[model samples]
Target: MEWNERIAFVRKAAGLTQEQLGQLLGVTRQAVSKWESAQTVPDAVTIARLCEALHVSADFVLLGKEPEPPDNAGDAPPYALPDTCPCCGRPVSGTICPVCGYTLPTTPPRGPRYAIVASRVSFVNEEDRAAELVKYCGMPESYAKAAVHQMQEYASFFLLRRNLTDSAAQWIAAHLDGSCFSLRIVQDNGEESNDALLTKPKAMELPAPAAPKQGGLGFWGVVGAVIVALLILSFF
Candidate 1:
């Protein structure tokens, strides 16, 4: 596809309108329209901004191809030894720092640990759920949002099953940061529900959750089913 088509495709895929993309780029909607119409091409800086905003690579936008991976894609950073401690800012070499006595961590920090739990409750969007997590669980806002999204995509199948509440709880617990932070999924039983697709993990480190062929029961579908079941139980 051409650059214009790629821009339009990515923008729509990201759930953004021309005006929204314009606002994000600090340009007018007409400007975005022109770009999408192939009347004008984004400059180098604007192209970079576009890539960042759309969460895509420049190569994909320009050539419709994923960028080639580096030869040492999975290798560690080129430099060795402690240039400075990430915690204390003291410089040292050859293992533990003498001044701070802090040893380098075995694995890189993957943000704060969190666990989510879902009962037979109404579905909540990730944004609101993220806010609740930060408000009640004392989680970092960015981390909470990302983690909520990850949980949703991987566990939507489990989320829809009323009898599998225990399984959902177990899944969350297993993924929680066992060392320091205790991220808990607080149940939100509000009336409103959404049917939006959850954001996917950018790169898969492990296998994805086994969901139904139809992309798991949508949030709204689950909500409707739960409400009907409740009504039936009440009538009985």
Candidate 2:
């Protein structure tokens, strides 16, 4: 193709319109149009700008020459992981297969892992709270039930599970927060600080019983006197 045609090709390949190309090159659309129509040619400085903007070598644009690949280009192996997991045959994310836990041998070492801990819940019953844990945190029903029971009965906080990726942990924490679970993310080693604690709903406290009014017959006082009179009558 002629150099003029090459300009049009590269501009279209870069997904830029004539006006957009002109904006990048600090020229008018009419100038870009004229260059494409062979009515004018870009000078050396403008050609350099065009090459930079279009990401094409000057030889490719001027002499229709394709850039040569590096000598060791073919020596490099292709990507080690497939678009889908080989074991589960499902689409995968990051380095690990979330479905079947299939990990690529060539995958790089991951960053710090995380663990999610449960502290409290707005739900009234342990079953409902356990269901929320299972839904949001993806824990098994048995494990979730046990965790909820532990959090409710014996512990102020329960370690739901550990060894989670950063993204997975964040996602679980957000969803648990949305579901009214008081939770926190900590390192896989189970270490946590006050700053790492997410919002935890305060445990509901029962109101203290009111003191009886002095010199007045309260309902309980009347019931107590009636019980004494019945005891005396029974003795008679």
Candidate 3:
């Protein structure tokens, strides 16, 4: 492909809008649009920036082939963790792309509630869970009522991180043993919402090597146990 075509291809493949690319490149959306349309081309400096942002070699952008790495520390391990979404080329280790909601093709299919057996909990609606928290944790009635929304906001950050970084996936795996939290939206008709992240999983970023176990639960597992312990205590 021509350089113009190549630029467009890499940008879209990188899961960046023209505006986003322009923002990264210190140009206007119009300029990026013009470049993709072949009305103009990026200068040498811009080309360098594009390569760095995309984590691709200049040769690949210019000639569509990545040159071989040197036989030294320069060469990355063949099985190094993914820093970008394979589908959209956006960096993410989450089950789905945050930018385009592209699920990893390799992620396994899931049912209504998919979680690691150890990490798995009952799929209660947020309202019910909030009520339980209030009653069980002895939290302020108002605070308990509003907890779900607050947690959801925090969850959004987790979701976004899941979408943009593979690190989320690794942490989930190492801690939960492949058990990841999924929220389901139940419709009045008794059907689950059609969101893929809720029902079907997408490509997940694999975690790096885990630390040595201290003969106990992982970090999240311990946290979960503490929550359960608190709930149990509240009953008394």
Q: Which candidate is the best by lDDT?
A: 2
For 1-236, candidate 1 gives per-residue lDDT tens digits of: 87689899888765567886786667889999999998986655566666654557666776677667889776976545445543334454433333322344435433322223332123356677666445433456797676567656654312211111223333333333332222233332331332211121211122233332223344334334434433543475
Per-residue lDDT over 88-195 for candidate 2, one digit per residue giving the tens place of the 0 to 100 score: 344654344444333433433378766666676555778877776665555688988887777667546776555565655654554454344566666664346433
TM-score per candidate, chains pooled: 0.32, 0.35, 0.33
Best-to-worst TM-score order = 2, 3, 1
Candidate 1 residue-pair clash tally: 1
The C-alpha lDDT values of all candidates are 0.49, 0.60, 0.47
Question: Cα deviation in Å at residue 140, candidate 2?
Answer: 2.6
RMSD of each: 23.9, 31.5, 19.4
Best by TM-score: 2
- What lDDT does model 3 reach? 0.47
Locate the minimum summed-lDDT window of 10 residues in model 3. 111-120
Report the Cα lDDT for residue 159, model 2. Answer: 63
